[model samples]
Target: MKKVCWPYFDPEFDSLSERIYGPTCRVCIDNESLEDCTVVKVDSLNKQGLLLEVVQVLTDMNLIISKGYISSDAGWFMDVFHVKDADGNKLADQRVINYIQQAIGTTRDPPKPKAYTTGKPLEPEPHSERTTIEMTGTDRPGLFSEISAALADLHCNVVEAHAWSHNARLACVAYISDQSTDTPIEDHHRLAAIEDRLTTVLRATTSSATAGGNCTNQQQREAKSGGGGGTMTNVERRLHQLMLSVRDFDRPLAMMEVASEEGGKASVLIESCREKGYSIVTVQCRDRPRLMFDTVCTLTDMQYVIFHASVDSHDGYAFQEYFIRHVDGCALNTEGEKERVVKCLEAAIERRVCEGVRLELSAKQRVGLLSDITRVLRENGLAVVRADVATHGGKAVNAFYVRDISGNDVDMEFVESMRREMGPIDLAVRNEKSLMPPNTADHQRPRFSISDILKSKIERFSHNFVAIK
Candidate 1:
């Protein structure tokens, strides 16, 4: 038999994780029968955003974390969370417990060499200009919160926002639109009002060149960053933005001033490189809870493996870039395939937001019931990717991920067919109802900074769009 090296097979592997973060970690989950909840426990070396990672895992599983307790001593962290699944039932499945542990507790894979870029590309703002408001002044705690409140008072909704602080200095940039119009504020008086209120809250007491002044209409474009330069710091700020506005995932009042919000919108770009055998997709949209998870799941169900990703959320907008190849290692070599990918993504995102939940069903545990349900979906050109089916007290409660056979969204007509075929089956589906507060924190690699994102964008443009004359 051929032997394979497991991660913990050698002593050196443990040392590597200890050197970088802290120590190899262990995670576990079990059902609390009395309370009817799941208890997720984590023991890991301390790292930045560690708790956030745990929460993200629970969120991804369609589970609600009702409460948590965590403690860190020296470099080790011990945490516990009580959670419930989407159906408000206690987690009884042992497989689900293992899945949670693997998601939040597993060691990160070692980094790999990237497709190195040799020079800086002319990084341009990919979207049309909107009102960009900047503020710089004395650094103070809660500066971001105060500024956000001020903007809210003026009925301005941020599309994207970034804040950086250093050695007692703070800088912030926000692209916003008045909630009334979803367009950039055109009234000079209203713009001045917003500027004045933000300045007061930021507490730039002494008016001077370095003391910080407000700039309008220019995003931090070329503006020197005061203190933040670390890649993780920038991502932390994006996560902060996500945490702040996850439940408030509303688009600006209207479309981008320069283009339509169609599949081929200005901020949504899809390109493929045959030479590299991968596809690159860049998307700019409103940030919301579970939005990124849903997006990744859609791609996975479509049989794509993401090789690289860069995600940023600011003001009120989110920018996501994914480098991927088909699960079978095929590039999106044809224009029709590329277009289908973009259109499908757009539709999936919209459906997730509009419908609020995917498919959930409950049926009698009988011979071939699950098979017959799957056959119904298959006959209607739908495929099921992820599913949780278990019989509790003689009833089968199941959750399923359904998509189109051609990697597009399941059609509404087909959905109705599913509903009819699933008749007599108590499909206790959950529809998205109320908005919950957004919880944000993330870490993934190979992480990219703003510059890296730009260069990649330019490369895709040169490779996929440009032509030799």
Candidate 2:
């Protein structure tokens, strides 16, 4: 059986054991505590991947974590998060609060299995309105264009999609449906043909620089369920896992070393906390949404337990410090292991950073729309680096991050021409920038590294925890 990549972490706490022996998960939502953001405090019995669960729930709800303190050092977990809605205001909605309480609160029920029947012929997986197609392989110019054209040829309409490329690899999850029926594609033979065509496109060209060697059938089949039910899967998390599976982190040590101090790259420093038998990992990077989740998820998936951690952001830079040990309870004792952790964490953060100009298109939903748009982009010598496509109330809203085939800046004149050609479809360029360091020269204040205040923060919040060097 193929391993499940989504919901990468599974909690071991059963409802009966949780109540009796007591994980006693208590989630306290305090909107009164902070003026700028709501303070959410979670206390529970510590277990593997618990931090990720809390963060995942919050992120999935579209809550932004501005600051946080986490401690699970003494076999109990405590997390204090200062979070806000997308508009940068405290969570004020009663319905949202109630949902959070029910989700992570003490009386929360265990998650039910997410299985459903579509009652359709030749359904490989339970689905709803649309089928989801997930693909990953060596990234090359016009690759998405080819896939889009292929789907259009197969009479499939793309309703939503998201794609990410990193380290010469691409992973995409696209929600699609039948062009004629406007429903989930249920014909198994048809799905196999689509799958076969896409696989051929993926393997048509391979560059030696592509990570993970050659793209294989096993990699493609991991999440190829022919149903929109895959929408329930966390698209971003699945992309991270897919990239990780392809060994995106496995780069030449010399090349990896060069990235350690590069601009726009995450800087990771791993040290030992021998007294506590923990590895101290500190990451400093440009602040962005879900930064903490990416880091925590990577560590958890790598079999590391974060005993204590602090996440803070100021001046558009994020600072994270984690005291961690292996699942087997040993600190990173070798240089190679530490370097691997650094490279993996860096890859995780970089996975979601879109490259190039972002163009948002809003129009009435129609079959072959994506194919037409991608075809136009390819004709204009633009290559999609990343994209997000969705539909609401019969309106198709899509965002594509694209660059010139030669890796130059995208031309606005071509974009305008394409907009006119598409007719009535609202196409606008959205200024989407990657997480980049703030220009220090523009500000008079002296810049300080996370290390300058790391000691003070650790000393203040982690008195009960062991000291680190």
The candidate maximizing TM-score is 2
For candidate 1, what is the lDDT? 0.50
- The number of residue pairs in model 1 that clash at the backbone is 9
Clashes of each: 9, 0
List model 1 lDDT by residue over 129-204, tens digit each.
3466656554333444455556666776554444543223444555565576656676877776776677666553
RMSD of 2: 12.7
Per lDDT, the best of the predicted structures is 2
| TM-scores for every candidate against the unseen true structure | 0.28, 0.80
* Candidate 2: stretches off by over 4 Å: 1-23, 106-128, 206-223, 226-233, 251-262, 407-409, 438-469
- The residue pairs that clash in candidate 2, if any, are none
Candidate RMSDs in Å, in order, are 27.0, 12.7
lDDT of each: 0.50, 0.74
Alpha carbon deviation, residue 468, candidate 1 (Å)? 50
